[model samples]
Target chain A: MAVRTPTGSPSGRALGLGAAAALLLLVGCCTVGLSMELQGTVSLEGRLFPQASAYQGQEDYDASLVLEPELYWEGEGGLSCSLKPFLRLDTSDPERSHSDLREANLLYGADSWQLLFGLDKVFWGVTEFVHLVDIVNQTDLVESPDQEEKLGQPMLALSLEQEWGTLEAYLLPLFRERTFPGSRGRLRGPLVIDSGAAEYESGAGRTHPDLALRYSHTLGNLDLGLYQFFGTSREPLFLPSAGQEEELIPFYSQISQTGLDLQLVEGQWLWKLEALQRSGQGPGRGAVACGFEYTWVRPWQLDLDLGFIAEYVRDQRRLADDSPYDNDLMLGMRLGLNDAQGSELLLGMVQDLAQPSCFMVLEAGQRLGESLHLSLSGYLFVRTAEQDPLRFYQQDSYLLFKGSYYF
Target chain B: MKRSLMLLLLLALMPVSPLQALAETPEEQGHAIAVEADRRSSGFGDCTADTVMILRNREGQENRRQLRSRVLEQEDDGDKSLTLFDSPGDVRGTILLTFSHKRGDDDQWLFLPALKRVKRISAANKSGAFMGSEFAFEDLGSRELEKYGHRYLGSESLDGRECFVLEQIPLDSKNSGYSRIISWLDTTTYRLIREEYFDQKQRLLKTLFCREYQQYLGFLWKAHRLEMVNHQNGKETDLLFANYRFQVGLTDRDFRKNRLKNLRTGGGR
Candidate 1:
């Protein structure tokens, strides 16, 4: 059928030219040897809403439409290459756009000495809710509109998923894209310190590129994450629009966090916990935000996400008078749809007043057919303000609609 | 994926050159050599297609079913046999699966669920689509190998291994797709390693390759990866056997008339 792309007029032309060039280059290369693959998907979400706050509500419709490259791989002569570019849109807000370019590199994986040079997901950690898709330390959710490059967030990393354990290292040329690339955007359920970029400097007072050690080590069922974001903390990568400076605030030269992520599963119960500590970056901002969530599968998936945040968030910024002691709690339920296919639908609600007040969301996604899918969702801003609301009930809401394909 | 595999490879690959003349054509010794070569090469197992497949349409949705492969049966030329099920309630009484070696005729019968009576599946409509899939009724049969003949065409290395090559052709006209079939069977157990099937027009239309063979139950053989590539449609099917079990004491008693309906009632729920 017909597909709707997920980029504005400016990038639409650029993306088309680039994707077409990639496709042609791949097709032409087939003359020399085996063919390289091209896979993509486009996810789209459209929502009609009346209120806007950084906080997402459980029932608020965060409807989105997406389109990603259809991904495929061909094996011949021991060398394999995978090419993918993901583009998605939320007609909900152009400012809240997302996209990515990924060529999970080329590899000559034989009996041993397997190495990869492309962009791929580097799975690390075992924290259930957050770690289930913890393959890459780069960007996952591309929320913002302006993206800097194709292969959106590129990383030259190598990994050995060995029998004993796994070892990995990445050259995150741009660290900002590592932490808050702002593209994969953020969902309301929980908080993951997205991606951070390392900034560099010049002796003449110019800002060069910085580096970071975004690595992970596995010890049995436990994983340790060591991330040191070394950059002129305030050196911005992209120019801000209008009142965007506050949202993209930068203060110092470096901020690093070390944490232990654990995953343990017994029978139908799964437990995930993370303990983190941040330090040496100026003032009160260096604190810890950790939580543990346990989920059960047999009877049905009922997940409870309780977070504890003790922080005086650093050197310089404040839009409104905020508190250092913020504790948020969220509960969610996932109902299984089809056992043959293991399809499911989810419902969740949370009260994290410290971050962006109180919000509730109701979202449902189902595999429509063999190749098509559909989702219906909406969200509500239950209550906002560090102090409890006087009325305790009035709230604004937004509803969303989404559909996708895998062919 | 599963449809085309049975389509191009099953009958269309039948060898037809057995009618060729060789030496004296004495009682047609090497005359139809191509047809003889075809049968002598592929599908040489003492196999039986006791396929007990049930087509399911989505519940309450016009023609859709929740096709829960409720029952399966395996039989060899020997007394060894087996039949399995998702439930015992159905095969308890009545069910009938008919196999007509003839090309265009095949039928099935079952005492359906909700309706406790005998029913017949149309045999004449062999080419009609099954569950709107590419597979036709004629394709699901254990057409006796003797029904077709084969001849050896010597040996050659294929995909890096030396194999015994043969060609085959169906004895009857109204049977399968191949004007003739060329096959490379492994010298060991006569298992099909690679086969090239030609259409009625004598053009190579498809190829079937079997790999990663493992012996199951001393009698049953398994091909972990069976690939059927279509020359017409740019799509290829790779059937990966993640799990398979054969001859676990299943019997004809499991393939009764009453069992079909019993299993369908709650087959996939």
Candidate 2:
């Protein structure tokens, strides 16, 4: 199998270089008495696979190192700037060794309005299992299978705050292609993804202008957010290469999406829902993720808190959509020890409603002393259906350990 | 005998001091003391403070966290507060905004820095520990006079100061960690000096000592240091407050959930 560079997107590289230069200039021209702070973390991760890799040349174990640093500068008159850069080096998979600028933005805030420019990350969702409405940033797929890591997006945003609610408008200028694991990575599909040959429906390609508007408000115990976005869809469709049978080419389409996310807090229970309707690609479709989390504080007279989570996800597009949460039920439990170390454990399982496929996840973390944090996570895929996308990685169960030092 | 009776009637007609009026029922006396304390601290308007929290285990191992707090006093209901965490690297820039209500459950929201997400959380976890410290969420919130039922437990001398002792039972017993709290207030200033917490099983669970009292605005008394010790687990926590600023012009806008994302930690202000 042949591998391509995952972080070699020309548009992302150009924006990253520009931001780096701007960050240096901003720091150099700072006046006296301005506040500057630097903080970050360095981590080492190790993964152990229980079975042999399904793809040839893939290793049974892997090691990686990551460094993420954040720098912030604040001056007088409500002006501030922040820069955060992320870098990871993998020993087994070359494509996993990537770097990104998570945030490099300048912000100016006034009494009732604010302006922001540059690369930034924004999250907008209420459900735990799947983020149906969070599409502002591209998913950093090689970094985590859980889809929590995101690549910074280049944007200019303005926000107006009032007694009723907050309204925000965003103008996105650049699009980042989703990353894919290399052939040597364990958690990958059967065919390699040639991200370098990705195609866009818009003539402007990566420079297509995207627009988004959102309004968020809190009424008593309920929090609500409504948004509309018109842009190149972050989710891509794959097609077999013309000549290469073992490779797939990604196709990006223009899309318009309307989303709503809501959360209600009632006593010990938190009810959440995220729904979205989109038009583009082949046909119009809708998706929803709904869930509730109920907490038992100090149950059985113990010094810990236990939270029960249940979520349901449904996507009308089904197999056409690349998400595994098309029709699924997720149930989980979270335990917090409430100790000096801040120990916590979360166990969850996502069961496919249409097939005999399920995925189990376990995550546990605790702190050592003040600056060091240790965490362990395991992912297991059970009997996947023939048409299920998860079938490609049915034998790729693995456990990962990470230790981070903060400064 | 007629002259003595005339003098008694005149004495009864005159005004009585607050201390003499305490000769009424214990419940009435306790209610009056609480009302007096609330009145004395009512007009501060707003305040901001920097706090260092130190948590110790049984073996004396300690961990520290730093935070900044801003509070805006409300005239009709409970106060609104915002707490920004500055330390522990991982939790830096996290903020907790609270809108406390006197009659029902408070509204709380947590802002996660990494995700830039604001989540409305259930206030039923008021008994849960705060940041893995001995202090619970309820302990750090605004203390409304209507949240508890009180009874006078007489007077006592603590640290050579005459203090009024009162027993308070939480109005919402299901959410509170303690069955009862015995508080000691200074007689002169009506400032809280000490507290003893009893668990749901009616066993003594923790003791808190408030010290280093300082007066702000020429009238408002604030405690600069508080120490809480868990008797059952042999763990302790100390809160050291500094840089107390009163009437700092904090308004309701400052505590809004939308503003949480813009707050810079590590004393950026």
Candidate 3:
């Protein structure tokens, strides 16, 4: 479970810090009419484990403080810049703490067309259980085991808005390797992920440029999207180095992917589907996730809505599948409270229908005060088999609490 | 007998029902009244306004939000409007675009700043609360005459002003949360004065009262304050409107979905 830091040298670490400060300074100089808006969050998060780990001296409780500051400068004539940097300090383990540049983008243009440059983030797909087609940014796994956080992606994006639909083209010049949990961190796989020891299939190595094209439009009650990407696959094939000393090496392959995302709205039902076909690393295969959400508004006149969700995800590989969801069924319930505090609760469970394994998740978030927000999330694995990826964390079930304050 | 004649003479001096002048059925009279109201409110071209919404819970705890709204009046079709949130820092810069249709379902899109994307929301979920307020999205839509079926109820004096009460049933009730709505319009100006909403279960749900009428451009009338009280949940939303600017010259391009992202605060028309 040891994670090797690519920037291990002292000077390398300082260079990263210096770059973040320089981005803020550049943003400050481009402001117009004192439009530099500073916003951030200071949060303390704690995780509690139900069972102690086998490793000796491993604490059952861990705490950390995270500071995420964001700055934006919106100048005149369609020129704007933004910088958001995150810093986390772990009280128990320094290696577990990390810093990431979430965004540092400059945008130009006004109405029909626009251009964006620098590091940015873009999300795709419509499923709640898994993001099968969202591969633009590298996963910031060190922040959380859920892999919802993403690192900044260096790219240039041009978008055109039209009556038929919106078309966007992206040029990604750099590749960012995914981060992993350090040795001191909990809820990690048995084998460590060494990001430094990574290989690329392309001869050009990390300099291989990635290209993406996306078109999204809403036709009547359906929201449809189509995407094509030619780039290195974000998911790596983990392998052990061929040496006496066993070390995990990640091999990334250049691949082409075509994806479609669609959502249909009818009365109280919302049908969503995300499908993708890809090739390169393994045999050509297709994956699809389809689901529906039924919402009841103001049920029993309580100023709240209850939504039921059911989804099925499948990969063509079936039993020989390394994919998390080969033949899985996901069921969920969402509670939206129509309150001024913007309260919401979601409970979901993904069960592998072909195996005796299930993963359950509970997430609840709400606004605390004018500028503060609170969130509670829990992950539980039930009856996981040895072949299941979640089996490694059978005893790693924990609850995380976060309280953030915005400035 | 002499006192009764004197009372009758006094009642004759009061305002008479305009519908009495024309011989028509109850339904026809209701349709005519609605058509006149729609006609009187038309031809303003475009308008901009600022609004403050106060939401109060059962315990009387209050939370407020501010918004700016721009509307483009359509001659033969439903109008288009854009609402931008200005207060409650968390929701600031959020935009809601609505395109209403006369015959079919309305379309709505929400621009969420955190997601940095425009989401096409379900127009069928009209019963859902709007921005955590008691007012539903259906209540914020343009009042197109073709969208409802009307029946004239008896007239009554409200707040010392003679009013015409009518029962309006949604033509397409599948997506609507209400079974019927009772609206009171000022007989003199065709301005909506009060409304009662009945839920799909035929239960009394909410009541809305409009007051403090202001004349814009010396011809069009608008309410300065609108209060909606939900009886079932004991929640209320009070909207105070101000700075009504008519003939601001907005166009269809200004309300496009893509324009929502770069929309300057308080800038359009």
Q: Is candidate 1 or candidate 2 better by TM-score?
A: 2
CAPRI level of candidate 1 = incorrect
Residue pairs with colliding backbones in model 3 are none
- Shift in Å, residue A89, candidate 3: 2.7
Q: Which residue runs of candidate 1 sit more than 4 Å off their true CA positions?
A: A1-29, A35-44, A50-65, A89-99, A102-104, A110-113, A121-151, A161-163, A175-253, A284-326, A339-343, A353-356, A386-396, B1-269
Per-residue C-alpha lDDT of model 2 across residues B77-136, encoded as one tens digit per residue:
899989998877667788999899988789988999878888788886599999999898
Worst 10-residue lDDT window, candidate 3 chain B: B1-10
Better of 2 and 3 by TM-score: 2
Instruction: Select the stronger candidate by DockQ from 1 and 2.
Output: 2
DockQ head-to-head 2 vs 3, winner: 2
Question: Across residues B207-238, which tens digit of lDDT does each residue of candidate 1 receive?
Answer: 77888887765644566666656575333444
Q: How well docked is model 3, in DockQ terms? A: 0.33
Pairing residues by index, what is the TM-score of model 1?
0.47
lDDT of 2 by residue, A1-407 (tens): 54545345687567667577757756763655668888989999999998978888788999999999988888888888888888999999988888888888888888888898888888899887788899999998988888888998988999999989999999999898888887888888878877767889999998899999999998888899999999999988988888789888788889999999999989999999999999886764899899999999999788999999999999875424378878899999999999888899999999999998999999999988778899999998977888788888888999999999889
TM-score of chain A of 1: 0.62
- What C-alpha lDDT, on a 0 to 100 scale, does residue A164 get in candidate 3? 89
As for lDDT, the candidate ahead, 1 or 3, is: 3
